[model samples]
Target: MLQFLHICNLALLDEVSLDFEAGFTAVTGETGAGKSVLLGALSMLAGNRVDKTIIRGGAEECIVEASLHVAGNKQLAELLDELELPPCEDGVLILRRSLHRKRGGKVQINGALATVTALQQLGEEWIDFHGPGEPQKLFHEKNQLALLDIFAKNSTALEAYQADFDQWRGLWREMENLRTAERLSPEEAEFLQSQINAINEVDPSDESIEQLERDFKRLDNARELGQLSEQAGEGAREAAQAASRVLRAARELAEIDPEADALAGRLDALIIEAEDLSSEYEALASGGDFDPSEAESIAQRMQTWLQIRRKYGPTTEAVRAKRDDLVRKIGSQTNVEGQLIKLEHRAGELEKSLRKQADELRRRRLKGAKDLAAQARELLTKLGFKKADFSIEVETENKLSRHGHSGCRFVFSPNAGQPLMPLNKIASSGETARVMLALKAVLAKADATALLVFDEVDANVGGEIGAAVGRELAALAGDHQVFCVTHLPQVAALARQHFLVEKGQDDSTTTVTICRIDEDKQRRESELARMLGDRDSKSARDHARQLMASV
Candidate 1:
């Protein structure tokens, strides 16, 4: 339940605070006395779009804040938890909205920064505002389906159907895309085949390219290499011969002198090393036959690599990647006939399941629709449409959707002899308001989280009918918090709490002020009476006294 509301710098309301109770609350004043301004402030807190022009003349921003005591509302608590917002420590949820004159604004829930969408979701759970010019929400197909679901208590089943429907829809779209891809024109198919053939002709491999390049370099420089190797071999052979001669002379000298023997041994080692070097040089000089034809082959192979790289990528690895991708696409194209068969079978199965679930849902909704019509008719009779008839038109389709195959349209007839027609087409704004109110009252038990706000529900209604509207609102207040803005004395008199919105001027500024009215105060009753009739008339006072006494 809403506990308090504080507003500042909104329209003519400079500053005001209203304390509310858990039952029916009424705001009453003369026309243009700022009652609607209060509702506008509440609307802001409820996350409605803000018009910056509502800012007061000297104020740069308008602020609207509300405190709701929701200790018993587990659903709201769960929502707060889901959003990761700090819960009301003392069971008080504080919502504040600030709108600037420059079309900027901020929203806060329980002192935590929140998005407008989040605020709106929370507000929908907490309030429902019915006013003139408010869109006819009941006429919307989605809302009608939601109402039917609520009546049938089929949330779980509807959720299951919706989940499956989403999956089936996704798969259907994928199948369509695959079919389109598989239906490529012959020219497109030929182009793709040409690309594949080009990639396959080069047949490039990582190490194969590197190894071939190495072999080509060696073959290209074979002549220079062979000449260098011959020169090295000749040098080694000359050194070996000279060392052999020196070693033979040293051995002869070693016989004459013992110290010469060590020199002779070192000479022998040098000759051995020279001989090994000469053998290596000789082997290298004997180069394998260098063929010009081999070089031509290498050049041709390199040309092939260059062509492939130019057409596809800079490297063999990149070309190979493209080849793999095309291979997968070709495989999918080859298997398309089989894939289509599978998709058709799956779609058939899904269609069967959808039909069955839709039929079950339709059964529940049809039953719920009858009950809803009966209830609405009963409430309409209470609101002075004694002979009105209410009905729900369920038109079933052969397709599947999240809301099943049935479309629900509410129809109404205001008089006994009149033909029932679509509610939106037949009911006036005032009549719609009352009908919506009646539906809300009936749905209150199931819609315990929703707060119903009625603006001029008493429009075009008076006397006992007005009193019945008041009684209905009062009754709705028993299960849900009710906020009503009214000009009717009967509705105002039914409020457990009443507020008087009055406009005042001080110096250069005009301000709207709200004050809570004590029901025991006769002056407040007289004021409401004046609003209903004439202020100074004895008859009005007497009638006001009677109204108060009856309440």
Candidate 2:
């Protein structure tokens, strides 16, 4: 769960830090009280793109940082490993993001530098938000399928199907290439053969390409290499000889002097070392003698390789791969009919395999759909949508999807007599918000993110239903840390923690403050009473006190 969130220099918020625990926390404020500013900061932390204009006035950058206690979540840890991010220390995963006004922002995970993409992946795995633009994205088809997959624990099965899908796609591409080649005119076939023959003709027999390259490097720098080797060799030899001669002159004296004798022995060793070096240097200076004929042949062969590389490569291996592909295509063209038949058969077999996997996916989806609909109906009923009918319906197309041969849609109806229609067709934004909230309640256990955020979940809800919505959120808080930005007092009254985000202006500068309400009963009552449309009224206070007491 997210334990800490810190934001600095973002929009109306100059700086704010909040500590959270495993429960539903409600944020309430006036319309322009920077409530959305907090959500915006959270969005950036989730790896969503941000504009530089969001930086607080007079600040050059904005920063959002979070600390999550992800202990025992092997799945999240494994995901971090897959992204090559630093592992949690003592069950803590730290994510920090900094956005600059004049440059692109930077992301860090556990203090090790990371990419926005990495942060986004982590967000996808651990964060489920139902809010203005982002949270509702969960209603999309892909996310719907993923929710079902998560419920079914279908990672391994999905991976197997994806692998088969890739193979089928590859075969289809190859078959198309073959068919295209078969339709090539005689001149086109001749041109392809010519390109292939050009590479095959440059055979450096008895020598690998690497060996040729090494030889060429040596021969190319031979002059400079020889000069340096000879110069150093001669200098060392002359110095050794001169020292030896000097020691020889003292040899006679060495018979009487112990120092002279020792010095002369050192000179003898030095002279031998110098001679060995000179011999080695001589070989370096004059070796690798390339005959004129062999040099010409090598130069021509290199030119051929370079020509092919320039056209088809950034490297030798790439050109080589392309060469092999061209050869296969040419061969297929020669036996066009036979190759076509083989490819068609292979494609048919792959399709059959893909269909088998698709069947299994369809069956699992149907089962999951039934389970989700049952849960959805019960959850909606709790949230005051007693007549709501929800279903996850799996439908098919003639073609296959990357997900499978089928897709699913959320069918919903707020009234009993109305025919069930697609969620987008009949669901209003507020209805969508409530529906999403109910789903979040249903999937709380299946969702591993640990952090669930709902923005304006009471958009279309009234006091009659606000208590029910609050109860569902409170129930979800037991297993996850949930955050809700709401305007309704009934909803805010149930929060484990309540905060007021107030915006003020002084001398043309806007400031946003997030104040944790006092635990004093009077202070809590006052805040709730304000939400009830009175800050100092007997009737409003009584209503606010009652709402707070119910929780």
Candidate 3:
């Protein structure tokens, strides 16, 4: 569960920190009081993208951090190990995110630097968010199928089907590529072959190309190099003679004065260096003589190498890669018919295997759909959907898809005698919210996420129905920590923990603050009374007290 949340320099929130526990926690505030700011903080913590404009005015960055108690979650432990993040100590995992104005943003897991993707992967295991917009996503068939799969516990089956499908798709693409190559015109084939032959004739390698370049330069500048070598050798010989003469003089002086021995040693070193320089110059002068016949051959080879580089690559490695690719394509063109027959046979066998696995998937979905609908219908009664008729229709298709050969749709009729139709076609936003809550209530145990967040899920619900929504949320809290952002006093009255968000401003800036009021009965009542329309009214407070007592 999320044990602590801290936000700094985020929008209207300069800084805020809250500690939470396992239970249904209600967050209540008037419109524009910055309740959404709290949701925004959680969203950023969940690895959602954020803009720099969300930073508080005059602030350089915004930060969101959370601490979770994950003592016995084996799944989270394995994920942490797989991502190479630091493991929990004494059942605590810390996640931190910071967004800067100019430097972008960064995510951290347990103090170890991590990517937003890693944070998201880990977040999925610990937190689940159901905001107002999330219910709309349920209208899509893909989301419906995914929910069914979760209920069915189809991980193993799905993995098997996906692997086989991936293999079949690869083989299919390869066969198509071969067919395309086989369809090339004679002119195209000739052009490709010419490119291949050019590279093959050169037989370029990194080391060989470098040596060829060096030899070409050396042979081309042979005459000029020979003249310079002679001049350098003459200069070195003269410098050596001069250093030798000075050393002899210094040696004579060293016999008279011992300090002069150091000078003689320095002159001796200079003479040795000059002699080595002269020897190198002499060697270069000798090698500078090149055979004309050899020079012509090297020049032609060098020109060919340059032309190949300009056409196919700016480097030898690129040239080699292009050559290999052309060769492979030509080979495929030559034996395309034979390879196509073999690949087609393999694809057929794999497609049969895929169909078999997909059949198993369809069977599981069919079974899971019935069970899910039955369970959800039972919960819908508790959420004030007394006569709601809900069912799932699994439609199987003839072709394979990324998911499977079957898709599922959520069919619903909100009232008795109403014709059942697709959820997106008939259900209102309020109905959708309640339906989603029912499904979530049914799947709470199957969901491993420790924290469940509902941002204004009771958007259009009020009065007794709101009370029922509160009860359902409270029930969900029996096993998971649940948070609801709501406006209903009845809902607020039932929370094990209640937080009040208030927007305040001094002359210079505005800020939103949230703090727990569950410990103060009068304060809780006052907040609930405010939600009832008038906090100062004695009657409202009395009603708030009564609501609290009933809960």
Residues 1-551, model 2: lDDT tens digits = 88899999989899989987778899999887889887887788788888889998899999999999999989889989998888999999899999998888999999999999888888876677776566554568887788887776777788998998898788778777767653667898799889888877764233566777776787787788889989978987887788778867778778888778887787788888888888888887877556778777777777787787789876767767887898876676677678768878987898898888888888888898899889989989877788889998888878887888878888889888988887666546667778888887777776666788888788877687988888888988987888899989989999999888998888978899997883668877998899889989999999998998888
lDDT value for model 1: 0.82
How would you encode candidate 1's per-residue C-alpha lDDT over 1-551 as one tens digit per residue? Answer: 88888898889877878788888988898888888887788778777787788988889998999998888788888999998888987888999999887766898999999988788778867877788765455767677778878888889988888888887887798789887774556676677777778677656687788887777777777778788888898898899899998887899999999899999999898888888998887787665345668777777777777787887788888999888887777678777878878888888888789888889989999999999889888999999898889888888986777788887888888888999887667557777788878888888777665467888788888999999999999999999889898888988888888888888877987777888875557767777778768878888888887777777
**Regarding TM-score, does 1 or 2 come out ahead?**
1
lDDT of 3: 0.87
Per-model CA lDDT versus the true structure: 0.82, 0.82, 0.87
Comparing 2 and 3 by lDDT, which wins?
A: 3
Give me the candidate number with maximum TM-score.
1
Question: Each model's TM-score?
Answer: 0.78, 0.68, 0.65
Top candidate by lDDT = 3
Better of 1 and 3 by lDDT: 3
lDDT score for residue 329 of model 2: 68
Ranked candidates, highest lDDT first? 3, 2, 1
Off by over 4 Å in 3: 70-92, 100-106, 112-125, 133-140, 177-339, 412-429, 505-509, 533-543, 549-551
Each prediction's RMSD over C-alphas, in Å, is: 4.9, 12.1, 11.3
